[model samples]
Target: MVTILNEQAEVDVTPLPRGGDGLWLSHADMTRATGFELKSEGLCRGEICVPVPKGRHDFARDDAIDIAGFWRYLGHPVAHDASRSVWALGTGAGTRRQALASLEAPDFTLPDLDGRPHALSDYRGRKVFLVSWASW
Candidate 1:
């Protein structure tokens, strides 16, 4: 099983066959899981085809493309648990660096313990830790 994630979403895609050393899935599964589909031109979504650089794709013998290789080639970082069943993909380091450079937190609205809605900008002049935990 692999878990596809971005800053705002997480989706689990299972029953994907494994390649020699990594997960592999069809372009359909790729679209369902990652919202990116391989088109005649390149990896596409809707009317946007992300132009994949030359030699980025490494298709397995069975035509199951390597999931890790695909994301890595696009500059995202991929990590798997020791069991190798749970995979987490994050935005590229360059994007994170750019976020830091901006010195602005992405806007979000969430409820506090008392069910009070709060946003990061609420404390415009205060420092926020914004700690989060997950038990998965």
Candidate 2:
């Protein structure tokens, strides 16, 4: 079994076929984990479909799709541990670029040094400077 970190939730999928570095999920698992289904048009989430690139044989096999590769193909980022059993999928580059262009920071809550929770949107109209750092 592997856990996929998508958006703000974690989806666990089982019955996975092994032997590849990329994550391969069954068609049903794909829909269950990501809500996207492979169709004649392409991978469809509701009415929106992204047509698969031509001449790409790596994305699909007998009964599985390479989700990690597909995410990369969609210009998104996929981060995982050395074991490749845990994966985190990020939004596509276009979506991220649009967010930056809007000039509005995405709402998120974080803890201050004193452990008080603070959300960026809490000071919507006020000027606030944010400093974040980590020591490795």
Candidate 3:
């Protein structure tokens, strides 16, 4: 399960559900999970070895492989099952690999709990560690 953002910007990648069964993802979730620095190369913000395809279309079909398209043609399903509505794609044609790229933390300004604008870039040149916890 990969969460993509901007389509032109790099993605942020992180593990799902504290070692749970399924991979859960969202645009904001990806950025916070991965770390800042979005690119098309599909590598972590600081590390190398991630792989993303170069072309936008399948070439054979001339259809674009935008996030949703990739999910469907690969045999995955996007559905609403009463409990949840999920959009999931397969790893690949036949490989068991999980993701094509790691998520990159995104940078943006949004209102905080107090309605003040929070700019992610404000932390530039500083090391920031963000941890996400949930009680369900």
Candidate 4:
């Protein structure tokens, strides 16, 4: 999800419904929903085209995008009031963020190659190291 810090608090965003004529989404939702696509390619869901920076599609793990700038470019608004000190993300039509369908982590219990039940959280307080190699 998109994370932003303002004078008052932090804001988290989630995805919105389809068929709505606006651009409103969380960072995670935007990444997944938009298939990790950025603006320059102009290929987006719902047949929408936005003009993004030339190399935005090549974003790396450490890269950051200005959410407010992106929103404004996509016809959305990053709204804020001096009194509230809160920033409200708005779609073109004044739509607010959507309710998250589920926030629970995915079930990851599974058996390893040796048929042993492996629970990720089992090592919560311990240090674990994973190593992998390819013979290619």
| Top TM-score model | 2
Stretches of candidate 3 exceeding 4 Å from the true structure? 1-70, 74-77, 81-111, 115-119, 134-136
List residue ranges in candidate 4 displaced over 4 A: 1-36, 39-43, 55-62, 81-86, 93-136
Residue 87 of model 2 has an lDDT of: 89
Q: List the pairs of residues colliding in candidate 3.
A: 10-39, 11-103, 11-104, 12-103, 12-104, 13-103, 35-105
lDDT of 1 at 3: 72
lDDT of 3 by residue, 56-122 (tens): 4331111211334334444444332343233333334332233323344556676767988877688
The count of residue-pair clashes in candidate 1 stands at 0
TM-score of each: 0.61, 0.67, 0.26, 0.32
Ranking by TM-score: 2, 1, 4, 3
Q: In candidate 2, what are the lDDT values of residues 1-136, reduced to their tens digit?
A: 8899988679998746666678888989888878889888888998879786555667766678888888887788899988777889888879888888998877788777898988899998888887787996
For each of the candidates, the C-alpha root-mean-square deviation to the true structure, in angstroms, is 5.3, 4.3, 13.0, 16.6
Model 4's lDDT to the true fold? 0.47
Model 1 ranges off by over 4 Å: 45-48, 52-56, 59-63, 99-105, 108-136
- For candidate 1, the 10 contiguous residues with the lowest summed lDDT are 55-64
Cα lDDT computed for each candidate against the true fold:
0.70, 0.82, 0.42, 0.47
